[model samples]
Target: MTSASAFWIAAVRARETGRGAPLFIDPFAHDLAGDYGYATMAASERVAGGENAFIPVRVRWFDDLTMTSAAAGVRQIVLLGAGLDTRAYRLDLPADADWYEVDRREIFQHKEPVLAEHSPRCQRHIVIADLGGDWAEPLLHAGLDPAARTLWLAEGLFFYLTEPMIVDLLHTAAALCGPASIVAADIIGTAGLDAAAMRGYRDWCDRNGVPPPFGADDPAALLHAGGWRAEHITTPGAADANYGRLPIQPGGRQPGRTHLVTASLATS
Candidate 1:
């Protein structure tokens, strides 16, 4: 499976278990992924699975983070690299809030039939543009009010971009945000990259026909340099603690290093 295939597999798993008094429920995810042909690709890999421990952990962390920000009155959610993610469908949110999902035109186009089949539970908008191209403009055009405080989620995406691209992305996000905006992203630190975990990550990428694009050894410095405040930074241990989940053991943790970061735009 490629990176794309891995994501679909994860979505299928989420959809299957999400309805069963699920730890979480994303009723629309599996069906949409299936409509888009990911289900067929994922089927062959399904039988080999034990529990995908990391997916559940990450999902719970994001669930908690989104709820926390919503409680603080966030009215907008921007999901960058929003591939097959079910947050907008599953998370409880205020009625007036808006959710914007950004991704490449090809990917979003692939999702249109799926979207038509299952409308999001919330006000949802899709911005189809390549992140390496003109994504920011399309997001603005999609009714993303930059003046409004928003929670931006860059989950499972940063590693697919180069460091310079990541820097530019943060800078662009900062410029678009109001003072109260917050960003939650996942990362893989240098230490983790150097550990045995890196081997597993490389193998996975190889199996999936993708290459690791980039990584940040220091997320704090990266965000700080891009003009955002590091409100909260956490290792897998810290994230697991916050969500009452267990950290991945030994090589089970994705190698090539990883961490999750939550940052906020500070008041000037």
Candidate 2:
């Protein structure tokens, strides 16, 4: 039951960090993952593969947007389902920035010991809750000002959630975000699930008990329906082009591949 998907991404970040010149250097990444994450990661590399262009590209895109939000005057950040994420410790965020990381209590338990050894770049608040349950109440009570702009990061969260859960989370975000808030999330879709190459990865998720039944044929439209305007939607190919990360595959990229979507509150 401790197969934390966040651990997988943290492992990827560590791999990327060990490189000559990384896209983002998460110094706290390696220890946060600890031994088990690295073990699963080695197995993943043996089976599926290493960190793909999609992951690092998505990471950088959101990092830039987060700084942009801060520059634009948003001082609060809420990382929902924030498993082993170390942005509060790594990013060169504004000194006034406040971060709230919400996750299951166990994730924080695993992360806090590692976090105690480092100095966070911003003020950090940890909220433990069942994200599928009443997670927001704890966050709001923890001093997340609804009237102030906050950058909400969902990252690798939505794929594991069912449709009703996703919609409910979106509505909650919209209600809490106020105007000028930005939300960034990465979502798997029908196209990715249906890909011949992605089957192995799907099997990996299934084996790990995280069956991804929630995906979209049209990710941008899905966000629009969920009450946000997807101002930027980048597919794997486009992200590769942006970061010069992935080589163009043979034939034009197929439809419904993974998408990194960035949106804003549409409460006008």
Q: Quote the lDDT for 150 in model 2.
A: 78
Query: Which tens-of-lDDT digit does each residue in 35-150 have in candidate 2?
Result: 78787677756655544556777778778888878888889999988888888888888878989999998898889998887788888889988888998899988888888887
**Local distance difference test, each candidate:** 0.69, 0.77
Query: 1-268 in candidate 1: lDDT tens per residue?
Result: 2336435545755554655455566666665566444554444345434333455666667888888888889889898888777677677877777999988766666567765665566789988877777788899999989888989998877867777778788888888878779988888665645444346556676787766645776677778777777777666645342344455333222334466778887554
Q: By TM-score, how accurate is candidate 2?
A: 0.89
Q: For each predicted model, how many residue pairs clash, with residues at least 3 apart or on different chains?
A: 11, 0
Clashes of 2: 0
How far is 133's C-alpha from truth in model 2 (Å)? 0.2
Candidate 1 ranges beyond 4 A from true positions: 1-6, 12-21, 35-52, 194-211, 239-244, 247-257, 266-268
- By summed lDDT, the worst window of 10 consecutive residues in model 1 runs over 248-257
